[model samples]
Target: MRRPATTRAITRATTLAAAALVAAGSLSACAVGGSDDGPLVVVSTNILGDVVENLVGDEVEVMTLMKPDADPHSFEISAQEAARLRSADLVVSNGLGLEEGLQQHLDAAADEDVPTFVAGDVIEVLEYAEGDAAGTPDSHFWTDPARVLDVVDALAPVLADLDGVDAGVVEEQAADYRAEVEQVDAEMTESFASIPAERRALVTNHHVFGYLADRFDFEVVGAVIPGGTTLAAPSASDLADLVGAVEETGVPTIFAESSSPDRLVQALASEADVHVDVVELFTESLTAPDGGAPDYLTMMRVNTERITDGLSA
Candidate 1:
């Protein structure tokens, strides 16, 4: 549920007008303080920020525009925050239209000729639904470690191109990271393969696991949201149809996303008389530092364990 374009425009206009007024008076220093210098890396979402930070280590300063547990569809940056986007030397985004709210800022940054990289662009996409409608690619490629290996592959060259970064060092590190990703992918494949082929079906809140299912050869029976993004609401008929599908498919678990509430899925489970395990998979954003699914590697591992356990029974 993103704010309307009109609302965003008004907000941006009002903030800029206020900044101008303050600059004319006494608050100029406060207004200018947000433009401090560093490596000037701008990441679209927090999950990608964690990945980039792990790749770059302490070599560069990174800032994530989206906060922890923030919905990617609706998260908005302030005017001062938008200034950071403009001043950044490198901008990394999830792409695949994950940052619906910050698209204008991204476009403006592109207009200014800031170097931008889309992590999802490197990975092969899984389209759950078709057409120019909103939320098509599902944007949950990180769920599959294989797909994220593609991201790591793209990221190495991009980091090498940045100023003050050693291309050779980044290349070696990227190769090491890609090996790790491949290992994880192998582990996931083995783990998920344990679930009997008959039970290798998934029921989720939305179309979050298309990539994972495709990679591991699981059937995506149905989703409560009935769309690629969580922004779409399921109508009563849609819910009824989904419940029927769940009953027909006999999927033992209905997985839920870490960032989205699961009340609807719970209710659907109760009404359908099926055992729905609300497995918290990292669908949109990564968890906080102390949370279970804190980073990309851990997130995929935890999700794999959960999915395997839930389906094996």
Candidate 2:
């Protein structure tokens, strides 16, 4: 059985924080690119890295730059990893301004003429409905399985065209993965539909669930932070407004991203007039294999169940 989100979240956050410190010292010594035999696909975030790995399997070497449980909005790459980007056969990123810290490296690779596949480019982008980032494109499209299918459809062709990858194998894997995404979408639709309309309000740590809310018919009541990126801080008045929304909506649960600490969400819950529970969801990055949200599919499933339970209660 999987551990409780609170238990797992605290453990993973503490472990990852220590790991980051250790990694800072050892990253330079660690290898960035894989062995020199096959075409290498360097991915910006671990979530998309898992997707590329699933699609290409052993056909090509896949290098994911972001560490597990790291914030994509602020995670930075080492000099070695940045150098490897220019030499990669294909560079994949969850663009739409998500990778704030790594954008320069991505741009550098693009300027060098490295082929790039941005997941945001192929999907119908959604803008933040109401926040400091209200008019900007949201990079959290992976929250919805349907949009993820769009990414897979566009990415499969790119991977197949790579020199060392087998077109037939990549095509077959893409089809199978597409089916999995479709199944998950159907399941999510059914699960979310069961939620009472009035109870389907969501409060989160940041504006990361617009895509999921748009896809599932949930109302985004408010967020602790006012924008799309976690790097931005929420003002006292901003928190006051969110507390009012929580009271007005009577939203019982507020979600915190697994990649970030839940202290802010906890504080928000405490300040709300209505009693609220804080739940953790895997929004930004994939976790290590032993972590609860190890891959994209599992991450979606885990979040679906958690959201359903949180709102229903």
Candidate 3:
């Protein structure tokens, strides 16, 4: 069964719905901040923010720069946040060109010698299989739980090195989270095993599923957008080409990422000759506390179930 929207999600939707009229007045009030005390760990994206929080618990203050439902490709940070990044005890970011807008700030933080951890560094990276970004390293490694476990394993030692954190506590917490991640991995493997080989094809808003496809032995049929980033738009010919691919593959469902608008995917489904269904997946970011995908593990499970159901039907 599909989950209902959380209270925080409803509140965020309402805020955005009214932003055009009230943004100017609400600018100062909406600024994000965390406690000035304790060891501060600044994270570029909310997805990583959740992971860091789970691993460290209340031992450190995690300041997640990206808001829930925000696109990491184009989400910009405030000057205050950038300053925080430079001064943070440790800064965590999803690297390999994922944070396009925040790259300069990340560079600035590193320039100032903030200990930084890039999640992409520890995993076996996959390249974009096709499109304009073909052959470029794909930074969406978290799609594969095995790769995510690599990140978890590498991160535990780093968190243990943090000055205020108890090394034993960090290791224990990471072990617990590691077990949870492994359980999700086993569940995903079992669930995806049920999908027929012919039906294991993915089409998304962009080329975000390359790692998932590589991990699960699925074919990346194509994408509505031509590249790895959602900031890029599709041309008419691009859409036409994708329509042909969809018709050829006869994939029942095409996915739209939650962090991006589904209009283009919906339009592509409408344009397809086959009866295509557009399903939303939490590809880039996590949702609020009451959301279906509030954390990394839940996000993967929700997506695994959705993909299984979407393709099985």
TM-scores for all candidates: the values are 0.84, 0.88, 0.87
Per-residue lDDT of 253 in model 1:
85
Clashes of 1: 0
Q: Which whole-number lDDT from 0 to 100 does residue 280 have in model 1?
A: 62
Report residue 10 deviation for candidate 3 (angstroms): 50
Residue pairs clashing in model 1 are: none
Worst 10 residues of 1 by lDDT: 29-38
Summarize candidate 3's per-residue lDDT along 87-194 as a digit string, tens digits.
Answer: 999999999899999999999999999999999999899888677888999988889889988988999899888887788888889999999999999999999999
Candidate 2 wrong stretches, greater than 4 Å:
1-34
Write model 2 residue lDDT over 88-191, tens digit each, in one string.
99999999999999999999999999999999999999998877899999999999999999999999999999997789999999998889889999989988
TM-score of 3: 0.87
10 residues in a row with least lDDT, candidate 2: 28-37
Decide which is better by TM-score, 1 or 2: 2
Which candidate should be chosen as best, given TM-score against the real structure? 2
Rank candidates, TM-score, best first: 2, 3, 1
User: For candidate 2, what is the lDDT?
Assistant: 0.91
